[model samples]
Target: MLTRTFLHFPQVGERRERALWRFGFCDWHAIVRSVAPSPWRHLWDEWQREAEASLEAYEVGNAAYFAMRLPKSAWWRAIPDFVHRAVFLDVETDGTHRITVLGIADSEGYRAFVRGQDNFDEARERLESAKMLVTYGGSHFDLPVLRANFPDWQLPPLHLDLCPLLRRLGLRGGLKAVERQVGLSRSPQTDGLNGWDAVHLWWRYVDGGDERALQTLLCYNREDVMPLPTLLALAYERLWAQTLKASQQTFLPMMGSKERRTG
Candidate 1:
């Protein structure tokens, strides 16, 4: 999807991109090798340079380039390509919204950073090294709380916020609700737990010294991060179909997904 995208080209919005697709410039390489007459022909030379640079960036797994070029709503295009460098994240806050627990997971495993107990060096390293960040409401809630908590931490450049993305797919409401709507089931322990419950659980451990509460809270946070990969994969499959259909292009196995069929 990254190689197939034209969004990185300057002044090339979705309309122009679709126009290119209609003209059979299906990917960056096609544009680089084309001499087709079109409205943007004069810009092709410049676009070709940019496309080459973009392709190099993609090949080297430099996700920040696309993150800066592509619009936030279209960050899904970078997901399939950079998912190995991606991390799923969620933050828990106290009553006043002070971040208490920070949870992150990558291909390796999940780790939680508690406010006073855990040093943030590892979390900071993980986030800074990550190419993409997946979160439910990180844009409005988790991220803001994180910034307040760690004012100087460098975050991942590309963020795929599932709240608005899922909303675009007509799956409305919180993460758990959207999860169930998409046929994802939570574990029995964390099934119905919500943000308020997370806060209360933190207090239960913090104020009452309840070890079970802390363990349960950790489980809940892990559960929040666990389903993110599947959700993004599902969203990518649906959005890719929508993009191809909207551009009126023949299916071309863009991501090497066996599920995509020629039409």
Candidate 2:
């Protein structure tokens, strides 16, 4: 999908991309092979160069170049080895702009960056290094809070928000609630907890400097992100099925927990 996305090129938007599709330019390769030679051909030439470079980077197991064009897109399914390039992100805040804890998990491990307790730069570095970022509701909540929290540094180039895709699949609820439908659940300590509980836990740590409370907060936050890979894969499979809805096959197997595992 990333390879077929033309919106990454300059002067192209959703409308322009659709126009390209109508003009018989359906994929990146199609645009590159087009011989119409319009005035916008220069842009396509430049994009061809970048697109080839991105694919090459992905082929070499290096996401460095492709990561630069990371934005919300349906193209991820086409990008090879995308699971390893992704980092799932979630943040706990005070219902406003104050972020008390920022959690991100990838193949490396689950990481929690607490305010005043750990180095914020560490989390920033980890996120910046990731090629893609996945979030459940980051479009409205997590990403805004993170940007406000770190005005200087930029997040990963691409962000995949699961909220819309989940809604399309009839999975409508909070993160934990949606997880429940899919047999994903939190541990005993974090079970039945809500956002308010997280706030109280943070307050407990801030007031008494209780590391236990802090640890619990981290654990709660970790649950928010741990199941993202499976969720993302499930979303992709569903969306792909929709594209082939005309087919007689009515069911697509969901990605297994083992497949979602980073290790």
Candidate 3:
């Protein structure tokens, strides 16, 4: 199941010094000089002071952050609990420049609606109500597209990002490659199309009114949603196993110190 954890990174502000130590230059100063070609030295002090204050607030627990955690054992259970509240989202855009359509699928079913379609409002309402959002590369693309298209819409927190997680674990390639590595199979209808193709296909139908084109686009969209549950299960399994291993290693060090002291 999709689970979320809020974490406070109190020391993230200290990263500025670390960055300067490693790079031999302050990030803001370097960026400003490179972009403007004019002296931005006066702005540096004010910027650094503001950044330090922001970091202090974060350390003091004034900043909030969230991450999705999925446990491996949860996947093998009779029921996948995470899917109950998770929404699998895929958007079909006219081009990389703009979002044209948003296709959302959940346990209930699927819906494909254009950004300005009559039913787009209803679909957006449903998205806002979901408990968790599951996607492959949403943090970089899908989430931004959704935010841009529906400026007022607020999505549930992301529960899992299969693509980056897989990459982090040294799994290579894109979603399809990960599927193969994990032994997840797909139908021919879906096998032939990738997300970019799906976006193009949907744009064709939405802009041209070709029923056949729409059918293929819907099939592709449905395919995108179908694999999400499996991907989520895999990610949960891997992350949970790693977490357990790390906990054991940490405990061992503490236990060893205690035993030495007692001896």
Candidate 4:
């Protein structure tokens, strides 16, 4: 999708990029390698330099460049081919202001980050280094809560908040509801848990020292994050199928269930 994107450069609006496309200047590499024609030749050298710099920035894992280059709508397509640098995020909080637990998954696997029981620094490190973030409702819930929790923390450059995207496909309501529509059924142990149940689990753990409650809470939290990548991938395919150009559209495999669960 990044290769198909022509939005990174200055002086190249949709109309101008269409001109380039007609002249066979289809992609960044094509533009850089071809000799520019008369009218645009004077600016070509500078554009080439910026293009190389942008590609280099991506190669070096410099996500800030992308933050500046891409519009939010294009973020989904711009996700890199390799997803190891991406993280799936979800949080379970007390009904009020406290975050009871968070589950984050990356290429390595998913784990629950429980308050007091674990260090946040490790989760913070993975979140900071991730290039993309996949979440069900992180934009409205998790992200704002996290920002309030840690004012200085920075999220990854690209975020695909699936709640709205799925809504685009007429899949409405909550995460569990969306999962059912998409055939991502939860396991029996965690199937019926909700945010309120999560709060109960936390209170039982903290007030009564019920270890079972904590484990169940973690299971619930883990379940919240585990299906994000697949859901996000499906959202991408369903929503983009109508809009993506023929040259840009291709079947992208969902991340392996093994990597998603274990990683």
Candidate 5:
């Protein structure tokens, strides 16, 4: 998907990108090999250099390079490519918007960092190590709270916020709502619980020393993170199909060795 992206090129918008795809310049290699005389021909050499640099950055696991170049909405294009180091994150906050639990899940499993019980430094460390971050509404909510709490900490290089992305796909509403729409379900223990419930659970644990409350909160957070990968996988397929339809592409071609090396 990253190779199929042309929006990173200068003066290229959605219209131009679709036009390029329709013109059979469907990937980086296609664009690099374009030989027909055109106004953009002068920039071909520069584009090739940039593409090579991007490929190098990808090979080195430098997700920030693509994050800086591509629009946030396009970050999904880089997800499958960087999924080896991708992590899903979600945060539980109190009424004051102070974070109580910071949960992160990778391919291994889920881990929760409670404000009082666990060291947030570990959360920061985990986040920093991730090449990509997948979150539902993290861009507007979870991430802002994290930035406020960890002022000096660096977030994952690529953040794929599914909130707007799913919205763009006509799947509006919150995480659980979208989940149900897409046939994802939660366990009975964590099902139906929402953010307010998380906040109350945290207070119950903090004020009344109710260990069960903390455990439940952690379970809720776990549920939140676990379904993200499935959701992202679904989105990628749906969007790819949409892109192919829009570009009138019947099938994907074999990418050249240089282009294949990056992924």
Candidate 6:
């Protein structure tokens, strides 16, 4: 028996069109002109208007609605706080470079879904809902696959490339390497399969319909989501503790001089 993932369809509304537009499924100008005759045309017009406003805001180097927009004084503090709710994302693709599945995890739990599953849709929806997204090496690879696969789906969320952040904190290497460096252990079930193998396994399952292959693929995907929280926690510890210590050291010199003057 195949284990299928489930997804719920959000109620049909204006946001769906906005999602489509955001991901570039259709041009706002073209859509607005084409839909002008329909009664629901107003909905499309409103969506396009809002999209234009959003683009205008971004053009001026402001991302006010995005999670990265924080007051300068609060920006550093916000990174750690926001990461707590972030969904760490990863993807597996076929040898031909087509994405076969996606994995995401947060405080709630981890989820992995094949391309056509309702669970895939649910995962996409959750991604759309997040205030921040955390991923290692997702900026160039994982994200492009997602946008390509779900052209009508809005982007997952405001992305935080944990790869750079991890580097900044002196942790070196890929996701698995970082896991090992930070002392996060993996379960025995995930022993043999790495991400590339996981993608091939999915292709085997999809093309050959081998149940054992599918099981292996799912297990690998589950493993991918499992370590993300630990990695995120480690990042938080390193950034927050280091930043706080630096702040104190910066202030310490002023304190000594003030004490000498008072004495």
Q: Tens digit of lDDT per residue, candidate 1, span 1-263? A: 66778887878899988888888887888877878577887897889899888767766777778888888878898776777788899998887769888999997789999888999899999998888889998899988888888889888889999888878888899989988898888888888999999999999999999989888888999889888888888788788888978888874444446422110
lDDT of 4: 0.75
Q: In model 6, which residue pairs have backbone atoms overlapping below 3 Å?
A: 6-118, 6-119, 7-118
* Model 3: per-residue Cα lDDT over 51-127, one tens digit each: 44433432432211222221322222112332455688877676774776567777577777755554787777777
Pairing residues by index, what is the TM-score of model 6? 0.62
Predictions in order: lDDT: 0.83, 0.72, 0.55, 0.75, 0.80, 0.57
- TM per prediction: 0.92, 0.72, 0.60, 0.82, 0.90, 0.62
Root-mean-square deviation per candidate = 3.5, 5.8, 13.8, 4.4, 3.0, 17.9
**TM-score for candidate 2:** 0.72
lDDT of 4 at 115: 90
Cα-based RMSD of candidate 4: 4.4
Give the per-residue lDDT digits (tens) of candidate 6, residues 1-263. 00000000122233453344333334323443454445445555555554454344434423234333332222223344345456778888885557776778876778777766645668877786665676787878788887777788766335766677788888888777877888776677676567777766877888888878877777777776677666666665566566436433222121112221100
- Which lDDT tens digits does candidate 2 get at residues 1-263? 44445666667776676566556665556655666458566676676765566556655655445445544455444323456767899999865789999898976888888787789988888887776788998999999888898988767666778887788889999888899898887899989988899998888888898889888888989888888888888887777566435222322233332322211
Worst 10 residues of 1 by lDDT: 254-263
Q: Which should have the higher TM-score, number 2 or number 6?
A: 2
Arrange candidates by lDDT, highest first: which order?
Answer: 1, 5, 4, 2, 6, 3
* Candidates ranked, most accurate by TM-score first: 1, 5, 4, 2, 6, 3
User: What number of clashing residue pairs does each candidate have, in the order they appear?
Assistant: 0, 6, 3, 4, 0, 3
Residue 99 CA error for candidate 6 (Å)? 2.1
What does the lDDT read for residue 32 in candidate 1?
Answer: 77
- lDDT string, candidate 5, 148-224, tens digits: 88789988788888888888889999999999999889999999999999999989998999999999999999999
